[model samples]
Target: MIKVIIFDLDNTLYNEKEYVISGFKAVALFLAREKSLDYCTVYSSLLESFVINERGKNFNYLCNKLNIDKSIIRRLVDVYREHYPEISLKEDIEMFLLELSRKYKLCLLTNGWLLPQKMKVESLRLDRYFDTIYYSQQDGLDLAKPHPKYFMKILQFYKIEASEALMIGDDPVADIQGAKDLNIPYFQISNELDDNEKQKIMQFLHNNI
Candidate 1:
């Protein structure tokens, strides 16, 4: 039986692309003011880079394309990370959490930079739903998901065995693999869940939890 439910933050409860877009808008505005460039163009370039899976190099891509100083890349990153993201959970997700919180212990396990993750939790008001929220970066990136230690930490905190917890997340590697390594049961879902997927998750809970 599942006594605790562990959730990944990005692309699980809410769409991670929304957060990326929101951060891009914030950085674009900041860059536009500092470099006298058009905000639309800057934002578009950032989005395009992201769409192409630029990964950690979006700022560099934008700077090289726009002839902006490379020295400012760090500042742009800071702006993106520090910005208060304009994001919200979907109504269905909100209701799902409300319902789940009433029944089982809910915990959030996410891997990301500390401040941005904290902002996301604050923005979504995840505190209302989750009994505990673990940011893996607090323990260092090496301790992030796919490493069994953080997962073990969560289990230890709740004083529950791995078999008693359910991991839900979008990433096949970080979230699912981590749970798998510890023999924790998991339900894989997409970043954005449609009606059918939501129903399937509910069915899984009913049958398993």
Candidate 2:
């Protein structure tokens, strides 16, 4: 019997697009304030340099690409920390996560850094529910998600059989298929996917579940 459910943080537990928009606006606002650039221009350049360059997960690359001056990145990170504490369970999530916790040994398996994720979780007070939160950076860059090793580490660390646990998350390539490859039950949360995208998530969940 499945006894554990591991949830991915960020969009998986909330409306994901809103989080992206807010983060973008935060970065854009900071850039505009410090560099005297228009919000749109800074947001655009940010998209190109970070997303297009596929450095979305790399903060150092973002620091360089944004021309972040001394202490700017730290300050902006602090800004994120300030705003993040206010972002809590979206829509049905708080209840859902709570309900799941009652029936299962629920954990959080996320693919982000410590500061931002920590602030968000702390602010949400979700620590009261989930038994554990495995931050990927705790294992270093090479062990991050989509690499297979990371997911396996979590499963082994918890002494969970792949068949005895479920992975619920947002990312398509990372959370979905990574857990799938390990023969675990996988569910994609359709927090912000469009109709077509929702169908894709449904299909994956339907097939896997």
Candidate 3:
């Protein structure tokens, strides 16, 4: 039985589309006003650079290299924090979580800056739902997800075996594969995969996982 279910925050818990629309609009507006750069160019280039670097939402590094003022990124992040609380939860998530809480402990294991994620939790009123929340930055740990140490740390901290836990999220490689690496089973919750890829993932999850 899965005693604990570890969840990812952004794009996993809430609707990814809402975050994209709000986050992009804020970034574009901030760039146009402060940097005098083309709104589209800055937004496009920032996303491209972020994808290339594989550092999702780590804007401090991007700010230092882009010659753009860190203030702009910080400002947008603040806007996101303010607006993100208004973001609605996905279908059945609220009810599903309520149902799950009665059976098993719910824990959140996410990697992000302190303010935005904290604001998100507050805005969504998620504190009452989870037994615990483990944030990479807030905890003063560099152990982000996809790193085996991150999963190991949670397991050790909770005093639960890998088999007793289930990691659920939308990201396949990061959350699914990462959990698998540490003998913790995972379930994919989004429909972002093609049929073939989905089948492969299905087998991977059950076979020796």
Q: List the residue pairs that clash in candidate 3.
A: none
lDDT of 2 by residue, 1-209 (tens): 66777788877765644555566677778767867868897666656665555534434555576665546667665655455644556545565566667767888877766777777678678797899877886778677776687678768877978988878777887788888889888777665323464355346544544
What shift in Å separates residue 12 of candidate 2 from its native position after superposition? 0.9
| Candidate 1 TM-score over all chains jointly | 0.93
The local lDDT score (0 to 100) that residue 42 gets in candidate 2 is 62
The C-alpha lDDT values of all candidates are 0.91, 0.69, 0.68
> Lowest-lDDT window of 10 residues in candidate 2?
192-201
Lowest-scoring 10 consecutive residues by lDDT in candidate 3? 192-201
Task: Give candidate 3's whole-model lDDT.
Answer: 0.68
Q: Among these predicted structures, which one has the highest TM-score?
A: 1
Candidate 3: where are CA atoms >4 Å away?
Answer: 24-78, 81-84, 139-142, 191-209
- Please give, for residues 68-131, the per-residue lDDT of candidate 1 as tens digits: 9899988888999999999999999898899989999999999999999999999999999999
Candidate 3 lDDT tens digits, 44-159 = 66566666664456466546656766666667666655555456665466766676677678898777677767767876678768988877776554566677777787788779
Structural similarity to truth (TM-score) of each candidate: 0.93, 0.65, 0.64
Whole-model lDDT, model 2:
0.69
Which parts of model 1 have CA positions greater than 4 angstroms off? none
Looking at model 2, residue 146 earns an lDDT score of: 68
